[model samples]
Target chain A: MRRALGWTVVVLTALVLQSTVFAQIKLGGTKPELVYLVTIVLAFLEGPASGAVAGFGGGMAQDFLLNQPKGITALTLTLLGYGVGLLRQYVVTPSPILPVVLVGASTTVGVLFYGVVRFLLGFNPGALYLIKVAVLAGVYNAILTPLLFPPIRRVAKATRANKVFRW
Target chain B: MALRSRPRNTRLVVISLVMMSLLTITLDYRGGQSGPFEVAGRATVAVVGALQNGVSKVVRPIGAFFSGIAHVASLQSENNKLKRQVADLQRRTAERVSLERENQRLLALAHLEQTLQLHGVTATVIGESVGNFEWSITINRGSSSGVKVDTPVVTGNGLVGHVIEVTPTTSKVQLIIDPSSAVAARLSSSGETGLLTGQRGKDLTMDLISVGAKVFPNEPVVTSGYQGGLYPPDIPVGFVSHVYQAPNDLTKLISVRPAVDFSSLEFVLVVTGGSSG
Candidate 1:
């Protein structure tokens, strides 16, 4: 119950930040996906199952909260969370740069997945622009990882799931 | 034996989650906002909107501070340039005053007062669209404030967008620059009518102008307010920034730059009721 509440707060905060503050801070005409960052980081801290669940919830919140077609974010983030978690279980990296690298790579894949889904759904906005958004948003999310990861790590530790994973 | 079953359980969970996501996507696409998913979405938006409004107020100043720091050098140069322009403008103030009086006299003769007053609720923009593809803003005013769906929204300079969705306390405005947005417009000088559609970014394309019509850069474009049109006539839309020949050569393609800057929008007026003549 406490874990659910904590994740809820974290997701809500991420949604607010994505729409309000980060919305103003545009780089190359794209803003960082704070929700994506939170989802991926939580997944990395926990494991695949929890990660996928968080992604679905966060994505649903985003789909309903914003104006884009529903389910695109949810679908993208769900797969991303699950994939990242699975990868984390197999690959244990002690390198300090792992978080940054993971964030940058995952963000790119997640955005590209979203674009492809939108395109298949007949909402293509052109491939070049999609590529641009994916690459730039990935870099932006990576840059923000350091600032966001530590706090998220702390929160994840407070949750029982984090405790179960450590042993 | 329990450890082996754990992997199986994980697989089952992942498969079920993926299936659920697919089901959501299919339902949303088929049913649209009228579907059950939309009801859930609306509820979520309403609850989150209050939180966003509160947090936005607290964070705006800090955001401004950081933005100010980033743009200080460019702002300084722009400030000096504006100072020189202000001195030049002051020198012409007397001449402009006479022209303004003449313009008022012309307007009175034209009986433009019937289309001038727009009484509506003013709303603050509390948030922006969370998705990348959709260009929109969320405003504080809602149905309770007499802001109805499809009501025309405008800034002081020109049209911004119309309200697409409304809750009791908040509303979503689909900006004029969204690709799906289209406005019927007329050229102020020639009165040539055309369909003005939004492009990818800040640009708009005015199409269907007669091949014989003469168009020039900087011609003012305003809403047609044609019979049964959504917006009232004479609301400033934009100015023609470029003109091109259509591929068929039967019409001209004109590029327009919107008068209101979407990026810096803070407040907007919702035209509640008036003559859309």
Candidate 2:
């Protein structure tokens, strides 16, 4: 219960920051997807189930809170959270840069998926523009991963179920 | 058996969540502005917007400080003693400059209001759209302030966008540069009309123009304000940056630079009591 509450607070704070501060600070005409970053990092910290839940909650909050297309973000983030969680279980890399690379790659894929979904909904902005936004947003999110991951990991650890050890 | 069931449960949970998201998307897509999804969205915005308004006020000064730093860093790097003096002077100057700039903008809006005989509520931008897919901003005014959907939002210079969503305390304005936006526009010089549409990260495009219409670069564009239109007539929209005719094309190709600089947009007027037809 505490874990759920903690994660909820994290997601809500991320939503606020994404719409306010990050919205004003655009680099190369793109801002970092702060909620997207938190969702993926949470997925990496928790398992698949927690990841999916975080994704849905975060995405829904973003869509509704920011006047975006209602559920598209929810759909995309749900799948991304689950996939990232599942993928993490199969990979074991000691490289410190793994989080950055994973974040960059996943953000690109998630944004591309979002673009394709928007296109299917008949809001075709253009393929070139979509790719440009996706790529730039990915790089932006990656740059933010280092600053965000440690704190999110700390929250996950603090909220995690206490481990039982047997001697 | 327990281990196998763990993975199964995980997959089951993910599947359920994905299904739930799909259902939401369908409902929201069909629901339009007045649907349950939109109402919930507005409520959420209201709650979050309150928090954001507070944060915006706090962070705005910090943002100004950083921008100020960029201007005076050269003086600071030259010498330590002079650096402190310059920093102090810069801070004071930045505050004065910002206030003056804001005063100028407000004064311009006032002048514009008098010139256009506009009756509207002035609003400050509180937040912006969180996603890259949409070009929109949240203003402090809402339905309570007489800001309704499709109400034209403008700066002192020209048209910015129209209200799309509104709660009691806040509203979202879709900027003219959004890819999905379209405005009914006229070339001020020739009196020829066309449908102006936005391109993502590019200049505005006015199409469906008559081939025989005398078009030229640098022509002023304004709202046509045809019958039952959404914008008031004679509001500046953009200026023709390029005009050309493509082979076998039915209409002239024209690119227009928007009159408003969206990046620096801070204040706008929501034409609440006006004939935007």
Candidate 3:
């Protein structure tokens, strides 16, 4: 219950920041997806199950709270979370650059996945444009990862520690 | 057995979640705004909107302060330019009194008051759409404040968008820049009509215009408000920035720069009612 509450608060706060504050601060006509960053960080710390769950919650929050096709983001984030979490279990890296690299690559992949889904759904805005947005958003998310990763990591660790103590 | 069961359970959970996401997508795609999914979405918006309103109020001043600092050098030059313009305007005001009288007569003949006399409910912008492909905003007014879905929203300069969803205390506005948005527009100078549509991250394009029609750069574009149209007539939409021949050769393509600076919008007026003559 405490874990759920903590994730909920984190997701809600990220949603608010993404929509209200960061929405105004556009970089090259694109805004950073803070929720995506949080999800990726949480997944890296917690593992596959937590990653998938966090991605779903965060994606759903985005879908319901913002304007977009409802399930597209949820679907994209779920896959991304699971994939990243699975990868984390194999690669044991202590490098500070891991988060930045993983976030940039995942964000790009997630965006492309979203665009392809939208295309299949007959909402294609053009492949070139989608590629441009994906690349730009990936770069923006990467730039933001260093700032966001540490706190997210701390929160995930603290929550797990509490859970272990309870058990 | 316990370890094996744990892996199986994890796999089952992942599969279940994926299926649930697919189900949601199917339902949302089929049911649209009237579906059960929308109810959940609306509930979330209502709760988040209240929090957003408070946060926006607290953050706006800080944002403005930083923005002001960033533009300090440009602002000084702009201030001087405005001062010179004000002096020129003052000098022209005396000579333009008779022209204003003549213009008012023409405006009355044109029945301009019908468009100008709209009853508006002023609302503060609480949040912007968080998605990459969507251009929208959340306002702090809703059914409680006489705001309704489909009501036109405008800033002082020109049209912003229309309300798409309304909760008791908040509403969602689909901005003119969204690719899904389209407005029936007419040129102010030639009165040539066309369909104005948004191109994602690009200037608005006015299509279905006659190839031979004369269009000049900077000509104002206003809503045509054709019969059964969503918006009322003569609302300012944008200005023509470029005109080119369509690839089809049967029509002309016109680019419009929207009158509203969507990125900086803080407040907007919701046209609740009034006649459009």
DockQ of each: 0.62, 0.58, 0.49
Query: What is candidate 1's lDDT per residue for A24-141, written digit by digit as tens?
Result: 7777778788888988998888887788888988888888876556877887888888889888887777987898999999999999999998889887767887898889989999
Model 1 stretches with alpha carbons more than 4 Å out: A162-167, B74-114, B246-249
TM-score (C-alpha, index-matched) for candidate 1: 0.88
- Ranking according to DockQ, highest score first: 1, 2, 3
Residue pair clashes in candidate 3 = none
TM-score of 3: 0.88
**Per-residue lDDT of B48-154 in model 1, one digit per residue for the tens?**
77777887666665555554555557877656654554454344333543543443443344344345665566677888887676788888878888988799887
Interface RMSD of 2: 3.2
Model 3 misplacement above 4 A:
A161-167, B66-115
- Find the candidate with the highest TM-score and give its number: 2
The 10-residue segment with the lowest total lDDT in model 1 chain B: B99-108
Name the lDDT of candidate 3.
0.79
Q: Top DockQ: which candidate number? A: 1
2 versus 3: better lDDT goes to: 2
**Model 2, range A43-155, lDDT digits (tens) per residue?**
88786788888999889988896444677888899999999988888888978898898899899899899889878888885888778888888898999898988989988
Model 2 residue runs over 4 Å out of place are: A66-68, A163-167, B64-111, B275-277
**Leading candidate by lDDT:** 2
